[model samples]
Target chain A: MKKDLNITPLNTLSLVDKVEMRITQYIKDNNLSVGDTIPKELQFAEALGVSRTVIREALSRLRTIGIIDSKKHKGMVLSHPDFIQNFEKVIDTNLLEDETLKDIFELRLILEMGMVDVLFARKTKEDLKELEEIVDRMETNNSESTIFKLENEVAFHGKLYEMSGNKTLQRFQNLLLPVFQYVHEHKLPDAEPYKYSKKFTTHRELLNYLKEDDIKAFKKGLSNHLEPHLDRILEKSKS
Target chain B: MKKDLNITPLNTLSLVDKVEMRITQYIKDNNLSVGDTIPKELQFAEALGVSRTVIREALSRLRTIGIIDSKKHKGMVLSHPDFIQNFEKVIDTNLLEDETLKDIFELRLILEMGMVDVLFARKTKEDLKELEEIVDRMETNNSESTIFKLENEVAFHGKLYEMSGNKTLQRFQNLLLPVFQYVHEHKLPDAEPYKYSKKFTTHRELLNYLKEDDIKAFKKGLSNHLEPHLDRILEKSKS
Candidate 1:
């Protein structure tokens, strides 16, 4: 069944874990793709010099993660991994470490800033209209306040993410939604000078930058919008 | 034993699935945080009117994903969720859909673009020196070529991600390395005009932009550097 790689299991990882890794490596090394038939468990066991039970356990882990499935007659087959799909369950807020939550929050901001060009290239009349309408709705409610409501902010920015047409980014945005909300919930006080600098970019202001098709201004606008959080993240790093 | 939430099991989802959702809901409603003690299985079973077997299965799923753990006499306690840690195993390219892979590649570029300010803020003498050395190493080998070697590219970009000082971004760059490698290996014939306007930004050119600390030009440089892949992602979306 096998005559190549040595199967001396290491002490650091469980045998099952070691087998799972080896199997993935085998698939990659062999250039197998989705729908490719995986060899039988017995073959794997014999090749790796491990028991069939260990092979089964490793296969079970892969199966649980949507990497492989048992075919009706063809035995196990590789399947497409829905890695982003797991974000729903993986993003349990109560369990994330503070630094991880902070890191994710930074990631969300980076994504927002990073997508500026994509949004410009892909924005439709309808897309801009939707974003403008969301901003308009927010402007109506704000008699004098600078910040928009969370729902309105979500609507405007969600539309922008939708405009980028990246499904992964859309789902990733959903995943980071909690981290941003969590940070806002436990928000640190903004630096007085930063706030007094009067550089806050409002919803409509950002929309105008988008409507004008200005990548630099839009990026700058987005940064200004996220300045408080950005400053907080940078401040924590320095300390 | 009685509970507020209605627990009639749904036809669509398994009983275990339903129980998992309800347990998470209970945790949120009760303001639970990390290390909080989880209620006993019997108590949950009685409260939700589900069998202890169903509760156990649901808890096992939670345990595997590391949302909760059993502590001495303290029973099950909440744990920090490591959503980012799973990216390594979850990012198996052998099983990812092409579209998903493309979207992820797009995300990596976006993260690179998005982390500009953070990179600028965090870049140190050591970081810049390392990046410069990588460029120098690449330049010496390039007798005459527009593109740098793949290893050199990885070193340069990996260093940039590190400069952002984002733990999550660093791991994410690792997750995306295969996607980029795969795309380059199976690269599409790039458009004709794109090959010529003379806009391909080289790695050292990007490093020089960074050294200058011109955020605007650096973003433009980064965008030029990624224009090919970005164009490909957008072109596919249109069709």
Candidate 2:
């Protein structure tokens, strides 16, 4: 109770707003199971002494993020999985601008660099097998065109991210996919794809290291994979 | 047009919904000056053959991020000096969860680490003076409570971020403030404050290095400042 003295109270909410926060907090506090119906909107709103419209807007935003689902007859239910699904739409609709793209691109690299330990710690044989197949496809593709290699490149490393078992990190990587594609498509030709290819061979080496669970080598491999991407962007900036 | 064909489109916006894209393109194409008003909403919407509502929605999203500002009488103008303000609200709302917080925290470190290069590139006597004052205060108030010290810690680093003179990076550092606060608030008790004080001394050393524009030492100092924070987080995780 004494500690509570140091904590400021949250801002006051309207009666309708109170009902909304109550429900959202209820879900979080109770760890509400997905697909379970929340209280009936009318019943819930009335119980909180708020109008239905106020409850509707809050629920609408939650539903917009896939945190809940609503049906005319069935009412509101919690169904939110990953919050990134909501963030993805916000970014995709041109809300995210050029600078945000660049910042996010840097964000992706930082995540990748930090992910090495996690990737090696949790990597599975099945994960390595998938990565090998992706690398094989990358080598066989003759065209210098980035478009062809970009998706495979994302997949190979994406699997590595999944190996981290950090769902949020994996989803964050995928969320930055558009920016990555934009960066790849507009990339300068000075950094040879040949150079990038050799670097990606490190991913295979990384897989080997992961099999042994070598944290040092795995970090080095992940860092090396990101180096060219960072270098290419920086180099493009100068040119 | 042929170049456009070479690039695969990654979005699903209808032409009407693509008004934001068109607006951005128009700004880049014409090299429109900042603070320039956009074409009349109705005219632009009609030319693009989209309803005013669609155009308005696109513009509103841009406005929310400080990319553009609208006046009831003056119409919409390109006014954004930075894009981070929008993200601040989202960050404050606790939209980013645990792992996203870690990713963001790493991002702050990357910026702090990368900043040595930029700092020397753009250092000034005034910046050095201000940073020293912050460090001096940290030393003078060795008995400062954790809450007060933590608040000053961000302020000091945030000042460093501002000194880098990169608007994009500064905004990001600010946007990540909530995540940084979250990490710092929950860390181990006894050793952290001491190690954190070492970071302040490193910050002073970084300023000395910056005064000489010695990037190598500045980089070393930057890394030193960040090491304790990272280690503190890492150590807490192990326990």
* Most lDDT-accurate candidate: 1
Q: Model 2, range A1-239, lDDT digits (tens) per residue?
A: 67669664566344534664687677656756656778876876777777787676556545434456665677776653343543554444433456556656655665676555445545678987787788778778847587777777777778877776666657767877876776556533446576665536355676677777677666556656667766665554445
Off by over 4 Å in 1: A1-12, A29-32, A36-57, A69-77, A143-148, A191-194, A197-199, B1-12, B36-57, B69-77, B144-148, B191-194, B197-199
Error of 2 at A214 (Å): 6.8
lDDT of 1 by residue, B105-160 (tens): 78888899889999998998888889999999998887745455767878888999
> Taking the candidates in order, what DockQ does each have?
0.54, 0.09
Interface RMSD of 1: 2.1
lDDT of 2 by residue, B1-239 (tens): 66668565657455534786787677667766556787877987888888887776566545534456666788877663343433543444453456566656655665575445445545678988888888888778769898778767777888887885666667777877777767656533335565464325455676677777786566556655666666654554456
- Give the proportion of true interface contacts each model preserves, from 0 to 1: 0.72, 0.05
Distance from true location, Cα of B7 in model 2, Å:
28
Tens-digit per-residue lDDT, A1-239, candidate 1: 55476685457477877898999899889988888999999999999999998898788767656688778899999888777755567676366777777888889989998988788888988988888888888878766454457778788888889999888899889878877888766854455584557758888888888888887788877888888878887887898
Q: Model 1: which residue pairs collide?
A: A95-B80, A95-B81
Q: Candidate 1, DockQ to 2 decimals?
A: 0.54
lDDT of 2 at B38: 78
Each model's TM-score, in the order given?
0.84, 0.56
